[model samples]
Target: MRTVTVLGAGSWGTALAIHAARRGRPTLLWTRTPEHQAAMAQERRNARYLPDFPFPEGLRTTDDLHQALDGAELVICGIPSHGMRAMMERVAQDFATRDAPAPMYLIAAKGIEVDTLSNMHQVLAQELPPSHRGRIAALGGPSFAAEVAKGLPTTVVVGSEDAHVGMSIQALLSGDGVRAYVTDDILGVELGGAFKNVIAMAAGIGDGAGLGDNARAGIITRGLAEISRLAISLGALPATLSGLAGLGDLVLTCTGGLSRNRRVGIALGQGKKLEEILAEMGMVAEGVKNTKSAYRLAQQQGVEMPLVSTMYAILYEGMAVREAVQALMGRALKAEREW
Candidate 1:
């Protein structure tokens, strides 16, 4: 019954819009690129991104911001983290024309800001009004767009500053196949989603190097410890890290074979150039961007995450992956547990 505005027409954005449309919501999806919007509108299919998934009849498409978000009861922002601030600024300028509505603002993006190192909700509060901050929520877990668009039995966490805000989102979308869980730890959910991409890349590198499951399991377990450590340092609940946002997402993205970031590392492990691998992928692999941010966050928080640091080096500093592996393996063995 809610008119949802999905403010991005990329793969994940279109997929989420399709889910809402399938639920019989009056969904409006927007694409900033005029050409993409036109194609999706004229063809009634987002062939560029969500191929084979037809845009539902009652669902709408637009290039104009005002037209898409106007009368929207829920705004689902699925843009990448790098563009989040700029997108919010453009939307904020347009918001001045309309009466301030208390619509639920959902962040479907999945990375921390590179410069500010802020979570998506913090980025929202910085760009939007203080009054709007309370309305902000995050939807994240280890969900592949293709699976979600196909109506797989997927479960995800909807987190907010208020437990009721998450519950409201749960009530808004709960149905037969998809399950939504509510939490009051938006920060944890967002960070877990962002950082897991980095660890998944590491796991992928292990797999590509033919290191076997023992190495991948080690990376996953240690990566989760670092995720929980960083999250707790930022005022998030430890249990939230163990939930869908942390452990569930880590398992899925690192080993699920659908992660683009993991695929990036796979090519790198096969001795492919970073530029070549990235060019072939032709997508926003968040781990490539998150590596620097995660390493920095770990350093600032005094959380020792050598794996994240070494991965950042491999991605940013021209360090060889083999050398990175040697360094990790050669580090002085301390207590296995950090807790």
Candidate 2:
């Protein structure tokens, strides 16, 4: 059996580790924090995240990155996007010191990097050694951590530029009520996963502001158009956006009660400060961060993304939610089909 190591001990990481271990793979769950490592090791559960799910016999916990990477056949990175480059740098350094072949990387994080405005795969390409870059794959779709930990039925897409790499991940992660689909459109997969969170925030804001389903449906439809425009501009396939990575994940995150980004937007719509809402949640809501990067990326790509820009203003520029509504609703009339 391939030994799988999951980097980061957040809810998603823990859930992935648990899933792999449950499948009887020898899995190591790595956290940079020693306290978290010790607690999971002793308790056989991640108290901070999934307290109800006990660790399977095949699962282990570690704080040392080197130790986790030592014999790993597959490395699943669940680290947040902002920290992806630094984490990959460390992984690259560790791989350089060892003569053994580097493990395949499965990036489970979603969102574009604010600093480089790069997607996760692009970030990995810049950070990992050239030889190992071909082994990089991304996991994205509508799987939530809590439900996944419970072994609920879930489907996700594994994308890679290399068909072999995508298939390898699909095989490794498929089973136990989880189905994996493979796609070669890595760019579309990453963009869809990243931008959907921003749109979900918009959905949540509408819900919190007491806007009905009609408004939400409008936001979702328009937000998808925005995502598709930018994604297609950057060489992504149009069909990929209509698949799991795009429409499926967008709808799930936008309406699901378990979505952190949507919840954060809910708090924002309720007139709570971003900082306050984030503080209360104590989890990474990728939308808040992605809103900034997507806004900048859209500008750089010369794509008009009104929803992303309005979200950027609300989150970073102190624009009121009411003002955002006006800005969106008051846009100049144009044909819905740009073509």
Off by over 4 Å in 2: none
Alpha-carbon local distance difference test for all models: 0.87, 0.92
Q: How many residue pairs clash in each candidate?
A: 0, 0
Model 2: per-residue Cα lDDT at residue 255: 92
Candidate 2 lDDT trough over 10 residues, lowest sum: 330-339
Q: Which stretches of candidate 1 lie over 4 Å from their true place?
A: none
Task: Identify the leading candidate in terms of lDDT.
Answer: 2
Candidate maximizing TM-score: 2
Query: Per-residue lDDT for 1-339 in model 2, tens only?
Result: 658999999999999999999988999999989999999999999999889999999999999998999888899999999999999999999989988776899999998999888899998989998889998888988999988989999999999988988998899889997999999999999999999999999999999998889999998999999999999999889988998999999999999999999999888889999999999999999999999989988898999999999999999999999989998899898888971
* 216-329: candidate 1 lDDT, tens digit per residue: 999999999988888899888898899999999999999987789899888888789889998887778988889989988988899888879889889889888889899999
* Cand. 2 Cα-lDDT: 0.92
Candidate 1 colliding pairs, count: 0
